[model samples]
Target: MASSDLTRKPTIRDVAAVAGLSHGTVSRVINGGHWVSPEARAAVEEAIRTTGYTTNHAARSLATGRSGSLAFLLTESQQLLFSDPTFALLLRGATAALAERAMTLVLLIADSPGEQANVERYVRAGHVDGVLLVSSHASDSLLASLVAAQVPTVCSGIPRAGDTPVPSVSIDEVGSARMMTRYLMDRGHRRIALITGPNDTPGGRFRLVGFREELGDRFDPGLVEQGPYERDSGNAAMTRLLERAPDIDAVFAASDVMAVGAIDALRR
Candidate 1:
C-alpha cells in the first residue's frame, strides 16, 4: 500500500479487518463489549491500539438517535452566575461526569423570561439527551416548560415544593443549616444572626426553616435578615442585623460569597 493511503485516518472497518472480525463485532466492542467474547474484545482493543482508530461520535449519535450531549442550565442573572463560585463548581462537576460517559455538556444561562423561552425551545428540539438544571428559583418558568415537554432532567437542588417532580441530587439543606445553628449555640453564641438568601429559592427557605427549628425559643425574628444571594445583599443584610442587634455574636450567611460579604460588613 502507498504511504499516503496508509496515513489515512483509521476507521472501524480497518480495525475489524486487522482484528480478523466482522465490523459488527468491532462496533459491539466499541459500544460496550456487551455480547462480544473476551478473546474478541482483546483482539479488537489491540487492533484499535495498533490502527489508532477513533470513533466518530457524531455519526454514532445520528445512527442511534441520541445526541450524546447534556445541558447544564442555570436560571440566574448573568451577574450572579459569573460572581458565584457555586455555579462554577456545578459546571465543573457536570462537565467531568458527562465526559466520563463520552458525552458533551452545553451550558445555558437563562436569566430573563425571553432567554428562558429560547432555552426551552432549543432544549425541546431534541438537541440534548438530558438536562442538568442548576440554581433554579421557585418561580422560574423554565422548570414547568421542561416538565411539560417531557425532556429528561435532573436538578442540582430539589425543584419547587409541589411542582413537577424532577429527579435531583442535593444535600439536606435544612439538616445542614440546623447542624450549623446548633454548633453556634453550643459555642455560647446566643445572639446568632442569619443572612438568608432570597426566599424564592429552595435553599434559602430550607435554611431559614432549619435555623428557626434549631434555635427553638432562641430564634429571634428581630435578628433575621433576608436578601438576595449576592455579596452586596449579604453585606447589606449583615449591616442591618448589626444595627438591629448590636449584641449579636455570630452570623450565618447562606452562601460562601454571602459569608465574604458578611465578613466585609463586620470589618466596616
Candidate 2:
C-alpha cells in the first residue's frame, strides 16, 4: 500500500462515506451524543466494524478543546491514602462519575516536592482538562503550584489554611467527630482518650476539636495524642495513652485503620 494510505487512520468521515451517511451522523453514533435513526445507526455501526474505525481522542480534544479526561492528584503519603478506607470509597465514587461521563481518569501521585513540581508542569502544559486535588499537607507546595497553573480543580478535602481557593467535597468532620464523642460521653465513658493523625489535616484537627467540644471544661488536653495514620502509629499512640491515662474507658482514633491499632493495643 502507498505510504499515504498506510499512514491514514480510519476516521468517522471514512465510516460515514462507507455507510452513505453524513459525518455528523457517524459522530453522533460513535460518541453516543445524540439520537440517530435505527436504520442509519445500524448501517454506521456496520461500517465502523468493517473499516475498524476508532475515534482518535487526541484529535477530538484538539477540535473540541476538551481532553475528555480528568486527573486525580493524590499528593499524600501513599501508605496513608492507599491504605485508608476513606480514600478507597473516594476512588470508587470518582471512577464511577468519570465512567458515566465517558471520560478518562489519570492518577497523579506526588509524594515529594520534586514529583509535585513535575505534576505542576504537566498541569501547566494542559495534560488534562481538570484536576481533583486530595490530601494536601500543610507544607505541601503543590497547592500553590496548582493555583498558579490556573487549572480547574476540585479538592477532595480542603488544603491547609492559606492554600488557594480550591473547591472541595468532604463530610463535615467536626460534626461527625462531635457525634462520635457524644456517643462515648452518653455511654458514661468519662476518662476518654483520643488518637489523632497529623493534626495538621482537617480529619485529625476536626476530630480532636470535636472531642474537646463534647467534653467541655472537663476535657483534659493531655488525654489527646497525635500519630502517623498508620497501624504502628496507632499502636504506639494507644500505648502512650494507656501509660498516660490507664483508667481510660474509651479511645477514638482518627481513622479506621488507626482504630484497629487501638483495638490491638486494647487487647494487649
Candidate 3:
C-alpha cells in the first residue's frame, strides 16, 4: 500500500514493510500473540515507532474474534477520580491487571445519563472486547444497560442487588467498613456519627450497612448522615451530623477524601 493512502494514522502493514517482515509477523509482534525472535521483534518495534504505526482495531477484530481492547467506564469526572484516593487505588490495580494481560485500556467518561447512553451504544457497536464499570450509585440505569448487553463485563466495586450478575472484583467493603467502625467503637466513642456515600451506590450502601451492622440500632438515629463521595460533601455532611447530634464523639466518613474533610471539620 502506498504511504499516501495512509490517512491520519499509519498501520501495521507500514511497519511490517519498514521492518522487512510479513504483515502476519508484524501483527504477531504487535498483538503479543506469540513469541518472536528478539531481533525481529526489535525491528518491528523500531519500525512501529518510526512510522508512528497504530493498530487497525476494526480490521483486527474482523480477523480475530477478540479485539484485545478493554473499556473502563467511569461515571465520575476525571477531576473527582484523580483527587479521590480510593479511585486512584482502583485505577492502579486495574492498570496493573490490564498491563499483565498486555491489553489496551480505553477510558469512557460517562458521568451523566446521556453519556451513559453513549457508552451503551458504543458497547453494542462492538467497539471493545470487554468492559469494566465503576459505578457510584446503586440501581443506576447504566448498570441495567450493561447487564442487558450481555457483554463480558467486570464491575470494579461492590454491586447493588441487580437483575443479573456481572462478574466483579472488589475489596470486602462491608468487612472493611466494619473494621473502620469498630476502631472508633474501641476508642471510647459512644455517640459516633457516620457520613456515608449515597445510599444507591454499591460501595455507599455496603459501607453504610456495615457501619450500621456494627454500631447497632441503639445509637440515636440522628447521628447517621448521607453525602456524596467527595471532600466538600463530606465536610458539609459532617457539619450537618454535628448540628443534629452535637454529642457525636467520633465520625466515620466513607472515603479517604471524605475522611480528610471530616477531620478538617473536627479540627475547625
Candidate 4:
C-alpha cells in the first residue's frame, strides 16, 4: 500500500475484509449481533481492534433511521439540579447505560420557558431517539408538548396531573413512606413529625398522604411542614417542627438530602 493509503482512516469494509467476513456480517455485529455466529462476532471484534476502526455514526444513523442518542431532560433550574446529588447519580447511571448500547446522552436543561421551547423544537426535529425526563414539576408544560409531538419519552418519576401517559421508572414513594411511618409508629413514635417535598410533585403529595394514613388520628397539623427537597429546607422544617411539637419523637423526611438536614437540625 502507498504511504497515503496506509495512513487513511479504516472503514467497515476494511474491517470486514480483515476479518475474512462479508460486510453484512460485520454490520450485524456492529448493530448488536442479532443473527451473526459467535465465531464471526469474535473475528469482527478482533479485526476492529487490529484496524482501530471507529463506527461512522452519521452514516449508520442515515441507514437505520436512528440517531442512537438519548436526552436527559431536567426541568428544574440549573442551580437546583447541580446542588442535588440525586441528579448527578441519575446522569452517571444514564450515561453508563447509553454507552453500553453504543448511544450518546444529551443533557437538556429546560428550566425557563425559552429553554423549554427550544428543547421541544429540538425533540420534534428528531435530534434524539428518545428522552429520559427528570425533576418535572406539576406546572411543567414540556411533558405535554413532548407527548403531543409523539416523541418517545420515559420519566424518572410518576407524571403529575395534566401529563399524558408516558412510560416511567420510579419507586413506590407512597408505599415506602407508609412503611417508614409504620415502622416508627410500631417502635412507639406516636409524636412523629413529617417534612414533605413541594405539594405540586407526585412524590411530595403521595408521601405526605402516606404519612398521614399511617399515623391515623395521631397526625397532628402542627407537626407537618412543607419544603423543597434540600438540606436547608430540611433543617428549617425540622427546626420549626421541633418548636411546634417539642414532644415529637421522630421525623420522616421526603428525601435523603432532607433527611441529612433534619439530622443536622437534631444535632444542633
Candidate 5:
C-alpha cells in the first residue's frame, strides 16, 4: 500500500508509483486506457483499486475547462424536495448513475424568482457541465433562459413551455394515465373523481387529458379538482370531490404522493 493512500487521499502520482509506471502513463490509462499496452492498463487498474484513488474533480475541471459535475436542479421550493418522495427517487437514481462516471451531482432548488436567478447564475458560471431539470412548470422561464444561454439541460419530464424543444427523459404520461383510468373503469367504477396535479405540468396536463378522454361522455366536470402534486393538496381535493359528489366510486390522482393523500381523505 502506498503511504499516501494511508496518510491521505491517493493521487495519480501515487497510483503511478504503485504501478511502477510514470505519472503520464497513469494519466493516459485514467483518461480511457487507450494508447497504452494491455499490461500497462492492467497494472494501472490494479494500482487504482489497491490505492482506492478517486479523480480530483477540481483539478480535472481546471485542466479541461469542464466542471465534471451536473446540477440536479429542481424548479420547486426547497422543502418540496424533501416532502415529495418522487424527488428522492430521482436524486438517488441520478446519484447512482453519476457515481459510475466519477462525476458529482449538485442539488439546487429554484421555486421563487430570487432562487431562480441564483440557480441561473450558478449554472451559467460553469459550476456544472449540464443540468438535470426536475419538477419544471409550464411557464417556467428557467428552461428558456438556460436554452438561451446555450447551457445543456435535460428535463425529467416532457416540458410544455419552451418553443425550442428541450431534451427530456419521460415516460408516456398520457398513455399511462389512460391505462390507469381504463383499469379503474374496467373494475366497474363509475362516478369517478379526478384529482389532477398542477395543470401546467406535463403529468398534470397530460394525465388530465388522458383521464378526460378515457371517461369521454361519462366524465363529470364537477368531479375534477386540481392541486399541487402534494399530499395535503390531494387530501383537500379528494375531500372536496367527496363532498361535491358523494356518489364518486373511484379516483385517479396524477402522482403516487397525491394518490396517497387521496387515500388519506377517504380514510377520514
Candidate 6:
C-alpha cells in the first residue's frame, strides 16, 4: 500500500483496484462465491493480503439486513458465568467459529426477568442473526420469548423438550454420572457422596438420576447434596455431605468447579 493510503483503513475498493477487477468481482470472491474462476479468486485474495484490507462488517450488515452477529446467551447469574471455566471455554470456541465467517458474538447474561426482557428486546431488534444459548433453566421464560420472536437458536445442552424447535447439543450426562459413581464403587469406596447440579437444569436433573440408578440399593439419600454448579455451592454441599455422613469415602460432583470445592472441603 502507498504511504498516502496508510492514514485510512483499506476498503474493498482498494482490494479491487489492486486486483485489477471490478468491486463486484472482489465482493463475490470475499463472500465465497463458486462462480469466480480460480485465477480471479486468487487475485482478489492476494490483493486483500497485500493491501491489508478488512471487511467493514457494519456496512455489509446494513446492506444485507443481517447484523452479522450471534448472541452467546447465558441464562445464569454473572457470578456463575465468570466463575465457571466451562463458560469461558464455550465462549472462546464460539468466538473462534464466528470469526472464521466474519461474524461477531454478543454475550448476554439473563438470570433475572428484567435481564431476560432486555435480551429479548435486543434480539427482536435484529441486532443478532441468532442466539447460541450457552446455559438455560427449565423454567426460564427467555427460551419461550426467543421462540415467540422466531429467532434461530442452538443450545449448548439439552433443554427441556418444548414446542419451540430450538436445536441443542449435549453429552451423555446420565451415563457420565453413572460411570463415575461406578468408578468410585470399583475403587472400594462404599460411603460415596454425590454433589449435583440444580433440579431445573438438564445436567442437574439427569446426572443425579444416573448416579441414583447406578448405586441402586446401595444409594444413600443422606449423602446426596444439591449444588448450583459453582465452587461455593460445591464447597457447601461437600461440607454438608460430610456432616451428614462423617465416614464418606468419595464424592462425585456434577461440575468441575464443584469438584475443586469438594477437594477444598477435604483439605479443610
Number of the top TM-score candidate: 1
lDDT of 2 by residue, 1-268 (tens): 2347546887787898889999898888877766798999899999988788877988787777778888888877778666788777877888899999888888888878888988888877877999998877787877777777788988887567887787888878888888988888899988888888787778888788888888898799889989777888888889998887889888877788889888898899
Clash count of each predicted structure = 0, 0, 2, 0, 0, 0
Worst lDDT 10-window in candidate 2: 1-10
| lDDT tens digits by residue: candidate 3, 113-175 | 788888889987878888888864664678777777777788887667754777878888899
Against the reference, the lDDT scores of all candidates come to: 0.89, 0.83, 0.80, 0.89, 0.88, 0.89
> What TM-score would every model get versus the actual structure?
0.91, 0.87, 0.79, 0.89, 0.89, 0.90
Cα lDDT tens digits for candidate 1, 1-268: 2367587888899899899999999999988748889999999999999888898988887877778899999888788877899989889988998889878999999988899999999999888998999878877878888989999999998788777888999889999999999999999889999888888888899999999999998898998888887899888988888887899999988898899889999999
Clashing residue pairs in candidate 3 are 138-200, 138-201
lDDT score for candidate 5 against the true structure = 0.88
Better of 1 and 4 by TM-score: 1
Off by over 4 Å in 4: none
Residue-by-residue lDDT tens digits, candidate 5, 1-268: 6344498888899899899999999999887647899999999999999888988877877877888789999998777788888899999999999999978899898998889999999999999999999978977888889999999989899887644788899989889988999999999998888888888888888888999899999988898999898889999999988887898888888877788899999999
Model 6 global lDDT (CA atoms, 0 to 1): 0.89
lDDT of 1 at 159: 86
> In model 2, which runs have C-alpha deviations exceeding 4 angstroms?
1-9, 28-50
RMSD, one per candidate, in order: 2.0, 3.2, 3.9, 2.2, 2.6, 2.2
